[model samples]
Target: MNTRDLQAFVAVVDSGSMVAAAAKLHLTQPGLTRRVQNLETLLGMPLLDRQSKPLKPTAAGRDVYALARNVLVAVDELMAAGAPDSEPSGELRIGVPPFLSELALERPIDRLRDAFPRLTLRVTAGWSPALVQGIERGALDVATVMVPASA
Candidate 1:
C-alpha cells in the first residue's frame, strides 16, 4: 500500500528470497517478512508463495508487482517535477522516423533538454508503420512519420 511496501515487494521478487531481500533492503528478515505479510493482509491475497524454495509470485502478485512498478515510477516522477524550479522531470516517450529521429529531432531535443535539464527523453526510431504501432501501444506519447505526398 505504501512505497516501502512496494519497494520491499519488488526487492523480494528480484532477490527471490526474504533473506536476500532483507539484506538488499537493509532490514532484518523478520521485518521484511512482516512488511510482506502486512501487504498481503492489506490486499487480501498472498503476493509470494512462501512454500516455494526460491519464492514465486502468484498471478495476483505478478499483477500487483507490475502496478507497483508503475506507481513507484510515477511517484518518483511526481517528486522530481514538484521540486522547486518548475522544470519537467519525467519520461517523455516519443517515436519518430529513422531519418528525422537522427536529424530533425536532434536540435529540438537538445533545446528541450537545455530548457528542462531534469526531463528524461525516450526516443524510439523506426519506419512509419512501427512508429504508428508504438504510438498505438502507449509506448510513445507522440510520433512523427512520413507519408507519400499528394500532388
Candidate 2:
C-alpha cells in the first residue's frame, strides 16, 4: 500500500523473519510485523506463512512480492531522476571496441565526473559482435561497433 509497507515486506522476505527484518530495517520487531500485517490486511490475503520456521512467502505472497519489488524499484528510480541538478547521477552502461575504449574513455570520463560527481559510468569492452549483442540484450545501454566500410 505504501513504500514503508513494501519495504517492510521486502525486508521480511530478505531476512526470513520478522525479528531479522526489523533489525535490518532499524525498526522494532513489533512495528515491522505491524507494517506487514497492515499490508496483508489491505491486500486481503496473508503474505507470509508464520508457521514456517523461516518465514516463507505463499503463492499469493510471492506474486505480491514481485510486484512490490518492481514498484519500489520504479519509485526509487523516479526519486533519483527527480533529484536536484546538484545530484546529477545515473547509471550508464556502455559497450565499446577495446581500442576505442582504451583511448576515448579516459578524458570523457574524467570530465563527466568533474561535471557530475555522482554520475556512475560503466564501460565494457569487447569485439564488434559481442558489443552489438550486448546492446541488443540491453546489458549495454549504448554501444559503438565497427563494421567494414563495404558492408
Candidate 3:
C-alpha cells in the first residue's frame, strides 16, 4: 500500500523475524508487525507464513519483496547522490589479474555499484606483470598483483 509498509515487510523478510526487523528499522516489534499486517490487508493476501521456520514469505510476498527491494535500492542511490560528502564519484581505471577476474570481480563490482553509483569503473584484465606495468606507467589507477616472495 505504501513505501513504509513495503519497507517493513521487506525488512521482515530480510531479517527473518519481526524482532530482528524491528531492531534493524528502529521500530518496536509490534509496530513492525502491524505495518506488515496493514500491507497484507491492503493487498488482500498474506505476505508471510508465520508457521514456517525462518518466517518464509508467501508467494505474493516474494513478488512484492523483489519490487520493494528495487525501490529501496533506487531510493538509496538517490539519497547518496544528494549527500556529496557521503557520496564518492569519479572514474577509476583498475587493472586486475586474469585469474582473479573470474574469481573475485563480482563482489567488488557490486560494492562499487552500491557505494559509488555515479562513478565509472574501467577494468582491464591481464597477467600480473602486465597489470603491474600498466600501474607503473600510470595507465591504471590501481592494480592487484600476486608474486613470489622473492619478487
Candidate 4:
C-alpha cells in the first residue's frame, strides 16, 4: 500500500471532509478521493461511511486510522533518523516551571529552534509536580523538576 494513499485517508478522516483534507494537502478534491479509494480498494473494504454527515470512518476505518497514524509518525521519525547532521524533526513537547520559562528559556529555546529548524516546539509552563506528571504520562517529552534540598 502506498503511504500517500494512507496519508490521504488519514487526512480526510481527520478533517472530516474530503474538501478540507484536499485543501490541507494542496490537492484537488478528486485527487484526494482517488487516493482514499485506492486505499479502500487495496484493503478490500470501505473505510468511510458515505451517508454520514461528518464523514465518520467505518469500523475498519477506525482501526486503519489508528494504525495509519502510528505508521505516519514512524515514517517521519525514520526520515529524521537518516537526516543530515542528525537534526531532530517532529514535535518536541517540553514542560518547564514558570520561573524557568521567564528567566532561562528564552535564549535556549531560540538556540534550539536555530539548531533544529524542522522541529516544532511546544512548551508548557507549569509547576514541578504538574510537569513531572506530564512527563510520566507521556504527554511531555521532557520536563524540569525541582525538589527541596532537604527532601
Candidate 5:
C-alpha cells in the first residue's frame, strides 16, 4: 500500500472530518476521499462509517489506525536517519495544561515556528494527567506536566 494513502487515512481518522483532513494535508476534499477509498479498496473493507455526523472508523479501521500510526512513525524515523541535517517538517503534536499554555509556552512556541517554518504544530490543552495520557497513547509527541515541588 502507498504511504500517502496510509497518511491520508490516518489524517481522516485523526480529524474525524474530510474537510479538516484535506486542509491539513493540503489536498482537495475529493482527492483526500479518493486516497481513502483507495486504501479501503485495497483492504476490501470500508474504513469509515459514512453515516455518522463526524466520520468514525469501522472496527477494521481501528486496527488499521493503530498499525498505520506505527508505520508512519517508523517511516519518518527512517527518513530522518538518512538525512540527519534535514530541515524538520510535518506535524508535531504537543500537549500542555491550560494554565501552563497561558503562562509559559508562547515564546518558545514562537521560536519553534520561526526555526521550522515547514513544521505544523498541533497543540492540545488539558489537565496534566490527561496530557500525560495523551503522550503515552502517542496522541501527543510531547507534553509538559506540573509536578509538585514536595514530590
Candidate 6:
C-alpha cells in the first residue's frame, strides 16, 4: 500500500522470519508483525503462509513482492537522477590502511573518475591511528580504518 509497507514486506520475505526480518528492518518483532498484518489487511489477503515452518509468502504476496521490488528500484533511480551529489565536483582526500600492499583500488578509483569528471582524489595509506588522527585534525576528508576486535 505504501513504500514502508512494501519495504517491510520485502525485508520480511528476504529475511524469512518475523524475528529476523524485524532485526533486518531495525523494528521490534511485534512491530514488524503488525506491519505485515496491516499490509495483509490493506490488501484483503494473507500475504504470508503462517501455517508453514520458515514461513513463506502467499501467491498474492509473490506478485506484490515482484512489483514492490520493481517499484522501489524505479523510485531509487528517480531519486538518484535528480541528486546533485551524483555529479560531485570537489577534491577529496581519503586514507587507507598502511598494511595494504599495493591495494587493488584502481577499479573503484577509475569508476569515480568516470562518474565525476571534475573531482580530484588524493589517497594516503597509513596506520589506523594516523588515519584517524588525520581525519580528526581535518587533514583528511575521509578515511577507511579498521578497528581491531580487541578495541
Highest TM-score scorer:
4
Across residues 33-60, which tens digit of lDDT does each residue of candidate 6 receive? 8888888899899998888778789999
State how far residue 146 of model 2 sits from its true place (Å). 9.7
RMSD, every candidate, angstroms = 4.2, 4.7, 10.3, 2.9, 4.2, 14.5
Q: TM-score per candidate, in order?
A: 0.65, 0.63, 0.58, 0.76, 0.63, 0.56
Give the poorly placed runs of model 1, Cα more than 4 Å off: 15-20, 86-125, 142-144
lDDT of 5 by residue, 45-87 (tens): 9999999868999999999999999999789878977998998
Task: Quote the lDDT for 50 in model 6.
Answer: 85
Q: lDDT per residue, candidate 4, 85-145, as tens digits?
A: 6767889999999999868999999999998898999999999999989999999999988
TM-score ranking of the models: 4, 1, 2, 5, 3, 6
List, residue by residue over 1-151, the lDDT tens digit for candidate 3: 5788889999999988889999999999999999999999998999999998789899998998998888876776777788868856656789888888767898988899888897888889988899888988988999888999985
Each candidate's number of clashing pairs is 0, 0, 0, 0, 0, 0
Quote model 2's TM-score: 0.63
TM-score of 4: 0.76
Of candidates 4 and 1, the better by lDDT: 4
lDDT of 3 at 63: 95
lDDT of each: 0.88, 0.88, 0.87, 0.93, 0.92, 0.83
Give the per-residue lDDT digits (tens) of candidate 1, residues 10-40. 8999889999999999999999988888889
